[model samples]
Target: MKHAQTFEIFLIAPPGLEQSLWKEARAKGFPSARYTTGGVTLKGGWEDVWRANLVMRGATRVLVRIGEFRAFHLAQLDKRCRKFDWAKYLRPDVPVRVEAVTNKKSKIYHAGAAKERVERAIAETLSAEISDEAPVTVKLRIDDNLCVFSLDTSGEALHKRGHKAAVGKAPMRETLAALFLGACGYDGQEPVLDPMCGSGTFVLEAAEIAAGMTPGRARSFAFEQLATFDGDAYAMVRATLPAPQRTSLSFHGSDRNAGAIENATANAERAGLSDNCHFRHASISDLQRPEGDPGLVIINPPYGARIGNKKQLFALYATLGTVLSERFSGWRVGIVTTDGQLARSTKLSFLPESAPIDHGGLRVKLFQTDPLP
Candidate 1:
């Protein structure tokens, strides 16, 4: 009897957030997990994969690397696919989708040809028909003359927890928001304030974590459709989830846009996290510190993509600097912006920081400030 094989967990983090993802993976009790530029690799079963998809905020998606082999040509790819133990993991009745990626040094550089070969191999090997529109997606990567096959345990990106009904104009993905929050060291034991909380994402993710909620409970994943899936095991693991802590974590968010406030409120409600999170209609000009243990303040203000101009937005940064400098002494701050000029106008020295995150093709930086002196 062959046992379930162990696979690597690929965590696609925002460009500058690798350390945060690695730190979170360790804190999740898989401390031995190794990390790389874009993600972390860990050992676990499907249950662990499911747990990672739900709880790992730092990861855009959690992928399970199932197969790795060298295939220099179409014949080699077909042979390798046929030799793979598809019967061990896939379900005959469940639909399957195969995706392929190619890079330099590969003769089979044409991705469409590779995808067709792999599909035919799977069909011929398993006597099953191929379907392009399956609910479950199997990912293939052929880079640097190496072919790696992985399963996207997360169906839609993990950010779409099936909750957020309303989104801001320059809305951030929930996964990216959580990862950014983690990068800023949001531990939930301390107050978290997002002055420019367009859709209340930073505050909401914080509230959920503070309340002891498992990010996966409120969502579903694609791995459940696999033939080898164990419902009993998953149910037991899920049953062990800690209850949402109802403490006053002081999760606060405000946006100048009235519509943004309303959207945040509705999003928080939909996430079942309204109790711990608060959204108000306010502006960066009106920010002040609240009395509590010193916590983190994160702002994803306008970066001139959808709102505000470079010159005009400097005023916004100046306002943010004034607000943080005056009221939130001793509170840590993180500001996301694309322009070094805009960051400089804040009048705060954010020395020794990494390059900006490349989100949507924009070079964005996470500027950190020293505690009030």
Candidate 2:
């Protein structure tokens, strides 16, 4: 019963990274894409939804606007929900979970009550069961007396990427890593090094991008469970993406902890990027530039507030700056830290700092420099 028509597709971006994601969407041929507070919006069909989930590297998740209606009260909400063509997008055999949010302006102030009304209506009218563990989900948002419905086409946050099972404390998410790399103007043609690469996130992501691999190729999506899903057609669409290309350059990572290096190596192997990414145990004092074309050295070094003492961190940052400046001429640098003073202690002439980004509750920013002269 699902009809083919354009609908608003929301691609969620991390806070303060909306402009980077918008550029990515536009470069990927979604020319009509526009930035929003926490994401980018564009008009596309279900196929576009699948593609967005599969190809977008900077997006945390993709939501498709399924339908909308105005309901002033819970009774009207239930009445309108029953009339909705649930069969068009949901299968009777598959379980679904419904979540709702309500604003004070709406007559239905209780989100739990609104969710219960819709759940009952779907169960009775469509004969579908509700389960907390269901892969498919329906989301409702009521604001200013208008109710909007959306489907979370991405079941799990896209940052999982189905490859990185190991992580250390205060690790960066893959989505954020990609956005940071893109912000640095990484085109995947040059080498990338992460001196503090935990779990090999930046190194592995760089390798995958360099090889033209789709971020979601190794994973499944919630769209596969929808009633209108066409596995064969979707497979063809995936096939049409640019094939992986051979790269002469290699990505690199290093850490002082042997366990961290092991985890990074294992993660890279699992992502089938071990050949392109290499990891070793080394301290900042022992660091040396790898032999390759002048490319990028991107790192999320430890900050004062979380991992180490503020007083001691200044020496560490100064040492990093001394090493990169002496050994890495012609290579660009991107350092992520929460404290501006800590970043300044490095003595690296970083360009104007990027907008403060929210990383797990703390405000962080990236400070970069042009190729060292």
Q: Best candidate per TM-score, number?
A: 2
- Candidate 2 clash pair list: none
Per-residue CA lDDT of model 2 for 1-373, tens digit only, reads 1467788999999999999999999988898899999999999987788899999999999999888999998899999999999999899999999999998988889999999999999999999999999999999999987989999999999998998888988889999999999999998988999888878899998999999888998899998999979888787789888888888889999998888899999998898887889998999888888896899999999887768787888988999999999999999999999999988888899899999998888889999999997
Question: What's the number of clashes in each of the models?
Answer: 4, 0
- Whole-model lDDT per candidate: 0.79, 0.91
Q: How close to the true structure is residue 216 of candidate 2, measured as C-alpha lDDT?
A: 95
Instruction: Tell me model 2's lDDT, rounded to 2 decimals.
Output: 0.91
| TM-score of structure candidate 1 | 0.93
Candidate 1 ranges beyond 4 A from true positions = 1-3, 127-132, 306-308
Query: Which has the greatest lDDT?
Result: 2
What would the per-residue lDDT of candidate 1 be over residues 1-373, giving only the tens digit for each residue? Answer: 1246567778777777777788888887675578888778888777677678766766788888887899888888888888998877777777788899898778779898899988887777766657876867778899876889888888778878788889978887777777777777677778889999988888888887777777766778887876667888777767766677787777889998999999999999898877778888888887767767878888888877657666678888888888888888788888877877787787876756756676767778888876655
RMSD of each: 2.1, 1.4
